[model samples]
Target chain A: MNYPIIVDVTLREGIADPEGATIERALPALGFNGISHVRAGKSFRMNIDAEDESSALAIAAALAQRLLSNPVIENATARSAAKG
Target chain B: MTRIGVVVFPGSNCEYDALGAVSALGAEAEFVWHSATHLDGFDGVILPGGFAHGDYLRPGALARFSPVMEAVAEFARAGGAVLGICNGFQVLTEAGLLPGALQKNRGLTFLCQPTTLTVESTASVLTRDAFRGQELVIPINHFSGSYTCDDETWASLVAHDQIVLRYKENPNGSRDDIAGVSNVEGNVVGLMPHPERAMSTLLGSADGRVLLESFVGAPVGAR
Candidate 1:
């Protein structure tokens, strides 16, 4: 089975992002108006193949721990469905 | 002895990792509290990446004003070795120790992958021993890793061979494929990826040893 993983790096609502702040300042001038709070982050998609759904999921979790995400700044997981 | 100092601010968790890496080379790694204002006796200083001041006012903005940063600035002015990794790189830029800023990923998400990096400069202590354009896989764990800078500085960076590391393939949409950079003096180096994460094959690739070893030109197997 193949599994999909998604990682989100956005700061929590209360968290501060200076990069986002800089981007926010430029948005109004770039013709993007009425938009508030632009936060920046990245994502990685990995298809892990295992014998079954449980195994696939386990691999995804291990990947997340070993290489796929920064545990401190991010919250990530694997999806049993392909949409993940 | 090459005394190295790792600045530890509120959100800096990688200080120990960097210390372990530096200590592997027989260099003693000292943890300097962010509030400290003096850096009088170290040969090298590294601002390992993390959310400093809780990532307030920008990644390194608040940290740039840290009392210790004054020492960092002074040390660099005297031609000292400085390496900033991930968030540390962000801080260096925020402090104007390096040019440009780290923007959000082009994909608008956080990417954590074992990315391949190309050696872009040999003149730098960070990349000197590696073959020109050598490729190494290191983990990139960040949201704001994209590097953006204007033209004049870009041209000078290219002309001076100050660009130290480049993505093997453009991953973050970093301008000019830049993954790392050095100051004009080639002593201060900052890169967006985590070389410390790839120090051993157990994690992924041991090639990081080569990259880290270039700092002191000898290997002690630390990361």
Candidate 2:
């Protein structure tokens, strides 16, 4: 069976997010209000040939941890696409 | 003559510059395509500056998986000297041959200019000829050059004397003004500056020759 998966990669807490901070800074000048703590990240979607959803999530989470996101500076989460 | 291999990824633009710089120092320099799986004839390997694999998915992230990297890893494991400059540094970190990661510059701006660096340690093949506290002027060109590592890694770096160079004045907000670093064994070194571009005073500074010469002159076997 093929299970669809999505991996979200984000900078770990305490790491600087210059791109997100820059966007947030510009938002105030653009008349947008009440927005803060912006962060930037990358997402990857894929289909895994696994027997079940749990196996699919495990495969995706491994991929995310090893390749999609660097553990040194980023955090990654993998989930079933159908759930979202 | 010492023979050096310069790994050339699909998008690498600094292979020729690295070749020229090493050749100018009387070393035989050759380009090793990223797919080559063996570095049999090279005494040292250099991963030069440039956007490898078009800097896709972050600089060096994709290129870290190239076949040549396997050979590079084996070479580094055997204590053969390996040097990574600029984008090459990013690849080293991605490959787990070095610690820390390069992030977008703090100001979110691309930087390209000369930078002054102080020699923090001469324990690595790249800086063994220079005296501690000696300064070198090199050029840096990058959009993402800020170096970040966790507190424990920072402590280990300090304790092991793995930090090889530090910017005389912080340029891109790198932690502790770090400009270059080496692995615990000191055979593998990576730096954000372009030493190959500083080969001659006519081009701005010849101090880069000091570092390159040190690399080329390292003992031929495991350290």
Candidate 3:
């Protein structure tokens, strides 16, 4: 079966996020208050042909580790999409 | 004379500059397209500056999968000198030949201009002839030039003397002022500054000659 996968890549905690910081700074002035933290990340959605969801997740995990995210400064997670 | 290959991606803008700079040093320089699968007869390979693959999905992410990278990786393994400048540096990190990643500048600004860099270690093939701590003025132009790495990797890089050039002024807020690094074998090097843009005194600094000359004169198959 083909399973849908979602891969999320984000900067690790303590790593500088200048793009996130810039957006966070803009939020307060635009009347969007009470938001303490704002971090930016990327998400990729794809369908993998595998035996089942678990196998698809494993393939997604490997893809996330090898390509979707750079381990030096970023972390990645893979999950099966809810609808797919 | 050393024959240099300047790898050219579709979006590469500085291949000609790198070609001119290397050729001016009396080394025969030629362009190697990204689709090429072999790097035969080239003693040095330079991934020059530019927005490869239009910097999509993050700089260097798409370009790292190009057919030429396979050849470039093979060349590095055989002890051929590989130099990655600016965006080329990003590709090297993405290709896992280098240890760190280039992030957006600390202030979220695109930086461009000349900067001073100190030669931290001459252990790399690209910097073997450079004097330790010698300063060179080179130009850098990019939005994502700040280098970031985890602590463990940073320690290993230091221990191996792979931390090559450090910015004298930390223009991009790189970790430990690192502007350049090399692999453990010293056959590969990646740096943010554009040595190709600093070849003449009229351009405000000829200090780049020190680094480029070192690469051109390095012994091949040293590993």
Model 2 TM-score? 0.97
Summarize candidate 1's per-residue lDDT along B1-223 as a digit string, tens digits: 7788899988998888888987886787799998898887777888998899887544676777788888888888877778899999988887788887776677567888988988978877688678887999988989888887767778989998889999988888788999999888788889988887887787788777776777755222211
Q: What CAPRI grade goes to candidate 2?
A: high
User: How many clashes (backbone atoms < 3 Å, residues ≥3 apart in a chain or on different chains) does model 1 have?
Assistant: 8
Q: Write the per-residue lDDT of candidate 1 for residues A7-48, one digit (tens) a residue.
A: 334443433456677788889899999988787665556677
Residue A17 displacement in candidate 2 (angstroms)? 0.8
Q: Looking at model 2 chain B, which ten-residue stretch has the lowest summed lDDT?
A: B214-223
What clash pairs does model 2 have? none
Candidate with more favorable, higher TM-score: 2 or 3: 2
Candidate 1: which stretches are off by over 4 Å?
A: A1-84, B217-223
A49: Cα error in model 2, Å = 2.5
lDDT of 3 by residue, B1-223 (tens): 8999999998999999999998898899999999999999998999999999999988999899999999999999898999999999999999999998999998988899999999999988778878998999998899999989989899999999999999989888899999999999998999999998999998799988878888887766754
- For each candidate in turn, the TM-score is 0.71, 0.97, 0.95
lDDT ranking, high to low? 2, 3, 1
Best by DockQ: 2
Give the Å shift of residue B100 in candidate 2: 0.7
Model 2, span A1-84: residue lDDT tens: 999899999999999999999999999789999999999999899989999999999989888887898999999999888865
Ranking by TM-score: 2, 3, 1
TM-scores of the candidates, chain A only: 0.63, 0.93, 0.95
